[model samples]
Target: MAESKDLLQVLWSGADVLRGKMDANEYKTYLLGLIFYKYLSDSYLAKVYDLLNDETPDDLQEAQKQYEEVMKTEDAKDLLQELRESMHYTLEPDMTYVSILNDAKGNSFNREKLQAAFNRIQESDELFNGLFADVDLYSNRLGTGDQKQSATIAEVIKVLDGADLIHAKGDVLGNAYEYLIGQFASETGKKAGEFYTPHGPAQILCRIAMTGQENKRGLQVYDPCMGSGSLMLSCRNYSTEPDYIKYYGQELMPSTYNLARMNMFLHRVHPENQHLRNGDTLDADWPTDEETEFDVVTMNPPYSAKWSAAEGFKQDERFMDYGGKLAPKSKADYAFLLHGFYHLKQTGTMAIVLPHGVLFRGAAEGTIRETLLKNGSIYAVIGLPANMFYNTSIPTCIVVLKKHREGRDVLFIDASNLYEKEKKQNVMNEEHIDKVLELYNNRKSVDKLAYLASYEDIKANDFNLNIPRYVDTSEEEDEVDIKALTNSIKETNKAIKESNTALVDMLNNLTFSSSETETAINEFIEILKEV
Candidate 1:
């Protein structure tokens, strides 16, 4: 744990080098993108060193030295081809990050060489095509002139060069990357919603959706709104076959989409298993042709975002099942839910985070709600504490659904009270998450914390899935003390009477200093007697 914190310190220090140069929303692209670039360069060198000497080197510089020596040999062409086949990309010795850092340390760095390395990585495979488009070394935000801009970038590289990403064990490096993303989210505030989800909710969402399918081989996962692919990537933690998990996702923003792509590679996901699209999830349906359904689906879409809600959508397969009704234009919460649900396999579990309004909203949303309830689609609703998100402080709920179920029974866990205030945000620590999961897995009612409502319970409320209707989170008022209360009031009245009598005596005994004071005292004494 201490080492992980140290790695995070080293990684975050790079952001400090560019803190004043641009906002986090912009600088995060440069810092994270460059960190990924260095990872790739160092990884390439390690692979080359292993292939050449049959043993990994102690450090990146050692690998770089051996690679430089090998490039002069006649067998270099064969070595490069083999590296391309195995790694799907090849970095020349001169273009490696270690080589570029050496140049920067010597005050002879060329920014163009770093840019060329980025371009080479992008060109080597379709998985990396246009990967670094968001990293603009020439952007004026870095500095005013060519020299200053290059120096600024060099400073960041020099800071990041200190972190030995290649030697970091387990998921330390990956967790460090996630830590940087979370820090950036903290800095960007509302805009952070575009590319990040707070870790607690993301963890619970994935865990609940993956409850029974943890050990399933080749588990297929999808997220309609895969912000930075964090939630989807979390499925690995709960899986016995972590590497066999395949990820499918879509995002509207190209830059965020680019971020998700980088996130996948940083986690070492295979290119073949990643099916991500850079497109609006609701504007159109994706993955329609190849493997449209998945074992687990999770999403934290923009809460109550507006969509077209066009008349044409009534016939769209994703929304058509809901009595030919579409979610309202002003609020697309239901729309996002249906899109993710439509892609869930029959045995799959789907979970989504949205505002509380969805459970009780009327009009078109009501129709969709009724259809979903009658179909036994919604499995459980977990109420999270308010202010758990970076963008919106409004409390949200995770609606866990299943396509085919034994009954229409729904488990309502009112975890709204299970959080601690951390600075300006509310956070759900492991204890809180474990409590909610305990209730969910138990599937039984707890007095005020959780309730398992039957289909009749839901129908009696007119199909309203409002949690408060089932689980009463309202605290039971403390019992009153009538006898003690009355005695206290009598004692208080006696005290006031004695005190007022003393006040009147003091006023009457006062030596009047002026005519005005004498008249005021006399009038007050007479008024006190009348009262």
Candidate 2:
């Protein structure tokens, strides 16, 4: 653990090397990509040393030396093939991050070598295609000229070279990567939403979605609008058989998609287990191949963002069940929800975060809500506190759904007041999250905190599904002690009258230093006498 902390400290210093000169979004690409490159290089050399010598080497430099010697031997081709089969990628000596860092130390580093290395990685495997597409070593933003850019890139590499990833465990490195992602999200503000989900809500989403499926082996989880794959990755923490868990996700933004790809690899997800894509999840339905539906589904799509919502979308299988209507063009919230919902197994649970508008907004959204409610798909609604997100302060809700559940009764939990006020944002700690889970498990009405509404209750409200309409968080006013309050007021007035009379008498005895003082004292005495 201490070693991991030190590694994190070493890794974060790379951010300091490029902090002031770069934007948070831009610098995160450089910082995370460089660190990821170091991980690959370090892990590669360590694996080679282990395979060749049957022992893990303590020093990466020594491993690199031995690896170079081996490449010149007759077994090199066999070693490369074994590497491709095991790690899904292979690195050349000249293209390795260790080699590049050594060159940086010798003042011989250049951008083209790093670019070649990136191209080699992309070419080495299908999983790594365009994996490092967002890292721009040649960008003018790095510096004013090519020489300066090379120097800047070299500086970043050196700053990240101290992490000792060869000795680090998977979770250690994965946690360090997650920490940097969170820091970037904090600094990037609104743009953060494109690639990151805040940790608090992420915990709630994963825990709720993985409640009963935690112990189940071979759990397949999918996220349609996965941001950085954090929400989907979060499910691993709740599982008893995490190694058997498979992940499927899609994201709209390419840069954000690339981040998710790197995030999956950093978390040590098996290449075969990571099924992610960079495409518009709503523009076209996906996962039309094998294993389309999953054991668990989660989403945090862009809230109320505009989509084409063309008439042609009515034919999309994901939306066709809703009486020939699609989500409106102005708000894609329901579009994303239905996309994830369509791919959920009958026994699986899904959790989605969106603005409060989705609960009560009439017209097309209302019709969709009614259909979902009548079908018993909407299971539970959890209201989160406002100012909880990096991008927007509007309070959001998590709508939990299960396909063909037994009843239309929905659990509504008003956790809006359940968070602690952290710096600039509201955070739900473990205690708060546990309370929510407890409420969900109990599935009973708690005064002002949660409510279990019957289908008739929701229908009476015209299928509004608004939490406040179901779970009234309003507190009843405390009964007034009128007689006791009157006596207290009389005693307070009596005390004030006694103090005022004493003050007036004291003022009358004071010898006036000037006519102005005498007049002021007289006016104050008159005011006090009236009081």
- Model 1 error, position 437 (Å): 0.3
Best by TM-score: 1
TM-score for all models, in order of appearance: 0.98, 0.93
Least well predicted 10-residue stretch by lDDT in candidate 2? 166-175
Can you write out model 2's per-residue Cα lDDT over 1-531, one digit (the tens) per residue? 798889879988989888888889999988888887888877888889989999999888888998999999999999999988888889998888889999999999978888888888889888888888989887888889888888988998988887887778777878788888888888989889877778889999999999899999989999988878889988999999988899998988888788888888888888888899888898888899778999999898888999999998888889988866788999999999999999999889999999999999999999999999999999999999999998898999999999987989999999999999988789889899899989999999999999999999999999997888988777789999999999999999999999999998898999977999999999999999999
Runs of candidate 1 with Cα error greater than 4 angstroms are none
Q: Candidate 2: give the clashing pairs.
A: none
Q: Give the per-residue lDDT of model 1 (tens digit) for 1-531.
A: 887888788888999989987899999999999999998898899999999889877887888998999899998999999999988899878799999999999998898899899999999998888889999999999999999999999999899887887778646777788888888999999999978889889889989999999999999999989989899998988999988999999999998898898888788888888999999899889988899999999999999999999999998999998887899998999999999999999999999999999999988899999999999998999999999998999999999999878999999999998988898689889998888889999999999999999999999999898899999877779999999999999999888888889899888777977999899889988887765
Any residue pairs clashing in model 1, and if so which?
A: none
Deviation from native of the Cα of residue 462 in model 1, angstroms: 1.5
Per-residue lDDT for 286 in model 1?
90
Measured with C-alpha atoms, the lDDT of residue 77 in candidate 1 is: 97
The TM-score, computed over Cα atoms with residue i paired to residue i, of candidate 2 is 0.93
Candidate 2 C-alpha error for residue 285, in Å: 0.4
